[model samples]
Target: MDTEAVNNARHGLRLLLVTLLLTSIGFFIYYVYRQALPKPLPGIPCDEVAAKKVLGSLPSMFSHWKQHGVVMPWLTGHNLKHNPPLVQFFGAPFAQPTVILSDFQESQDILLRRGKECDRADRTLQSFEGMIPHHHLAMRTNGPRFKGNKELVRYLMSPKFLHEASAVQIYEKSLALIDLWSLKVKTSGGKPFPARQDIFDAALDMVSGAAFGFKDDLSITKRQLNHFLSNGVKFKEHENGSVDFHGFLFFGYIVAGHETTSSSLSWALKFIADHQTEQDKLRQALWEAFPDAAAEKRVPNVKITTTHVPYLDGIIDECMRLETSQTKITVGSWSVDDMHLFKPERWLKTGDSGELVYDS
Candidate 1:
């Protein structure tokens, strides 16, 4: 062939190479987008109705799950026999490679054996840190300042401190509750009245006393603490923005300590009320244990001691189990830097082998 023909053939080859390169790049971009996009989870679409029901009857639902040792099929559409709890998160996407441990052994291993593997710096933490700068002491026990403060907290908030504080708070709040109930009953001419508000007041007072060394009067301390938490530290107003780590911890503790404790006590009463015979037994036991303080006026003098009441402890423990507040703690994650945050995709999904995988 002539030199011109050879040059034309080379030019065609160059054009073909460029076309192939462009095609490959386009395909890559599309693939990345698909991987990153938050696709609608196959069957579960948030299920607002189910969520409402679950929240409304949280106690009973948790009780059923605990008793059965598996999430109920009616609620979760899964069972222990065939559909294991591990697959519940198979379809969703998260920032971390999370191992959903439904089995007792697996859960114990992840939560206990390898808890440190899962770090807890997430979007929520950003909000929390902003709201409460001091919340970090509860989470990360690093740095000299944190370490020293933690040691101080450990010593000051020891079991002895807790016991004394709890005893005084419970006794005082219970007395206040008894008075409120009696007054309400008198005003209502002994008719049945809603006890929830009164119970909530007592629980709030108790938690306030324990946490802040004083009852909650919705003062600056309480308002600042709770308001900062509810609103979060608005680091940014746009749909997406960073938050404070301390604020996140504040929310965690509020739920962990205050909410959980109140729910436990409330459930304890509910359980006893459900089982009248058990309640009667408890009343009799209380009287026997505190014979001198059995009278209405002397009730405030009655103290709750561990040795004096084994059954009461058992009941409270059972109530806690029934409440199932333990399983709600979850670790979430998000990109801390702005450059990493712009990529809107990267969610959790199961790998080809049907195992959960993180793609952040």
Candidate 2:
């Protein structure tokens, strides 16, 4: 063969190899892109725009969280947008889509009755496992660890245990909270002051005392009260401010109890403060229920307090229904009307004896 023809043949072979390499690279890239896209489960409703995106609903969720400082509302808002009993969203890139059941009865059935069919999600287990490896919350229901852990704490939920053991500690913490609030009221001189931290501290103290058997001296609410009383420090009324924290270790207990209770109490306080009529009714009912304590200018003990104060029970039930600390799914079909309104009366009804009774 001629030298020029040999050189042309070698150049043509090199061009063919480069073309195959580039084509292979292009196909790999396309394959990865397709795999990264959202995959909705069969027959589940999902946002149409989100299904097309690589990150699915995450970008929109992030945007909503940036604006609102929380994401549950955004997730719940999807119910309104889709108008469905169930909606799915991709929480992360290349993750299985999360199916959110908005119907209250259906959610309850799945969570309570259909345990064999629907168990805890992997994301929930992963979240707890990172923080508390051996905690029962991190384990599946069918797992031996979960059964053993549950057996260990089964007595904690008994009414006798709660009344005999937990109630006294909680009552002491409650007194500390009242004292702390009284000081704040005097210092603020009728001006509104931030109560979120105080509420959280009180809740922490109550939980710590009940769970760990901490004494009154170690109570957060008591310590704060003593600090203000000893120093005579006047609280500065501010729209928003940061407070100093005494160092303490964060635990799964805080996640399981403290945050939930504090958030619920904070909402309860806000709702009562906003509605004067309901507040008055609650006070009147309490005073009437505990006439001796009211006459003596003393708060009722745990026993008396637990004895049905219908209005107070109604207020508590209504507050929990209105601003639940956990994620807000849609209400049941029966109670969907005026669910947004803070009306304690919704929980009150005429009993068989024609007396006002608290209804769940």
lDDT of 1 by residue, 143-247 (tens): 345655445346334668666776676676666666555655665678886665446546766665665566544322333334434654421111212323233
Model 1: per-residue Cα lDDT at residue 169: 69
Off by over 4 Å in 1: 1-29, 37-83, 90-114, 117-127, 133-149, 181-201, 215-256, 295-297, 300-302, 327-360
- TM-score of candidate 2 against the unseen true structure: 0.81
Scored by CA lDDT, what does every candidate get?
0.50, 0.78
Task: Please report how far candidate 2 places residue 74 from its true position, in Å.
Answer: 3.2
Count of clashing pairs, candidate 1: 16
